[model samples]
Target: MKILIIEDEIQLVQSISEYLQTENYTCEYALTYRQAVHKVLKHNYDCILLDLMLPGGDGMQILEEMKRLKKMDGVIIISARGAFEDKISGLQIGADDYLSKPFHLPELAARIYSVVRRRNFGNSNIIDENELQINLLAKTATINNVELSLTKKEFDLLLYFISNRNCVISKNALAEHLSGDIAGMLDNYDYIYAHIKNLKKKLNDAGCRNYLKTIYGSGYKWEI
Candidate 1:
């Protein structure tokens, strides 16, 4: 999953990004309100960690803009404003959850997980797509009840595809989702090709149909 962290605190952003990375989440950050707006306009994230007090504008304003854009990305207000009214306002605006500052990293992660789950999978941890079954808790994908031995990256890629099934996902999106921050620095996408190839082989070898398709110069799609 991918997250956008909109906060001006440099240290907090770094710490949160690193912790989320450890949980296999791709993170992008914006330090200013303008940057945050630009990012939200340009890309799709599974969740957004928004701070209310921003450099140029209030985070509530950003929430308004997001609502106007009709974006469905899950949002969690991670602000120092811990008042009951602040929490109520955020939830009323569209935030899925509110996390006061000085909070535990694990708790933040759990909240993000819950929000993303509610948004993407209707709060279900398991995904059943025809003969393919994925247990999000176990991080396992099985075909006809036979488990496939997949690497972490491979499993993540599978989930990404499954979640966005029937949509043509660009290679750039896949690369960023896999490499996270380093994706911006890398010039080559050979790694993506290699992983996709391996994932395709594994699934096809396990008596699964080739649901994954390449769209010529566009990208790949899961058309099942």
Candidate 2:
């Protein structure tokens, strides 16, 4: 999934981004409220990790703006202020979850998964689609009770397609989802083809139907 981290602490931001990246999540960072707002306006994010205190403006104001735009993006508030009132206000303002500072990275990761699950996958850890079963927490996929070995990229691609089933996903969109903002720097999306091809092949080899389709000049679709 693609995540936006609106944190002012450079070390914390880098650590969180690196940790999430290791788990196959594409991350973008914004150190100030202005930069955060610019990113929210420019790109689509699966979830946003927002810090309450920020330079230039408060993160609550950013949340208000997002709600005004009807963005429907999931948000998790992370702040040093651990007061009950702060948590209450965040939830009242539509924050999906809250995490106090000095929290464990793994705990933060789990919270992000929970928020995304609630927002996109019906709040379930196990996503089942007929013969295909995916354990989001374990990051494993099984076809007809048989585990299919997949590279991290292949697994992420499959999950992305499944979550957005029936929607036509353009190559550029897929590239951006997989690589985040840096996708724009690439010359071509040849890597996307490679990942999709490998994922499809692996699934088919494991007795899964060809649910992934290529649309000539358009892109791909996951027709489950």
Candidate 3:
């Protein structure tokens, strides 16, 4: 999943990014209100770690912008301000969860997983898509009662594709989702192609239909 971290503290941002990356999450950053607003407007993320205080503007304004635009991206306010009023206001403005500054990285990861899971799976840890079943917590996939030995990246790619099934997904979006920090510097998408090929082969070997379709001169679509 993709995450946006909106915080001005360089050290905190780096730490969060590194920790989340280890949890198999792709992260992007916005150190200022303007940058945060711009990224929120231009791209879609599974979750956003928002800091209430920002350089250019108050982070509450970002919440308002999201509300105005009717964006459904899950947001978790991670601010140093632990006031009761701040928590209430953030939830009232549509944040999914609130975490104070002095929190553990594992807890923060857990919250992010909860938010993304609720947003995408609607209270279920297991995703059932046709004959394909995925246990989100275990990060395992099975098709037609046969298990596939998929790499972590392959499993994640499969889940992402299935979640967004029948929708056209660009190579750039996949690259960014799969490769967090290195995405911005990517000059080619060969790695994506390799992963897709391997995933398709594995699925096909398991007697699953090839539902992933390539759009010539465009990107890919999970036709299922």
TM-scores vs. true structure, each candidate: 0.57, 0.58, 0.57
Tens digits of per-residue lDDT for model 3, 60-108: 8999899999999999999899888999999999999998876656557
lDDT of 3 at 75: 98
> Higher TM-score: candidate 1 or 2?
2
Off by over 4 Å in 1: 127-224
Q: List the residue pairs that clash in candidate 3.
A: none
Where model 3 places Cα greater than 4 Å from the true spot, the runs are 127-224
Residue 192, candidate 3: C-alpha displacement in angstroms: 43
lDDT of 2 by residue, 1-224 (tens): 99999999999999889878866789999999899999998888999999989999999999989888988889999999877898998999899999888665655775786678877876367988889999887889999999999999898888777755665667887877678667879999998999999999999999998889998998887886
Model 2 weakest 10-residue run by lDDT: 102-111
**Total backbone clashes of candidate 3, pairs 3 or more residues apart or in separate chains:** 0
For residue 138, what is the lDDT in candidate 1?
Answer: 82
Q: What are the lDDT scores of the predictions, listed in order?
A: 0.86, 0.85, 0.86
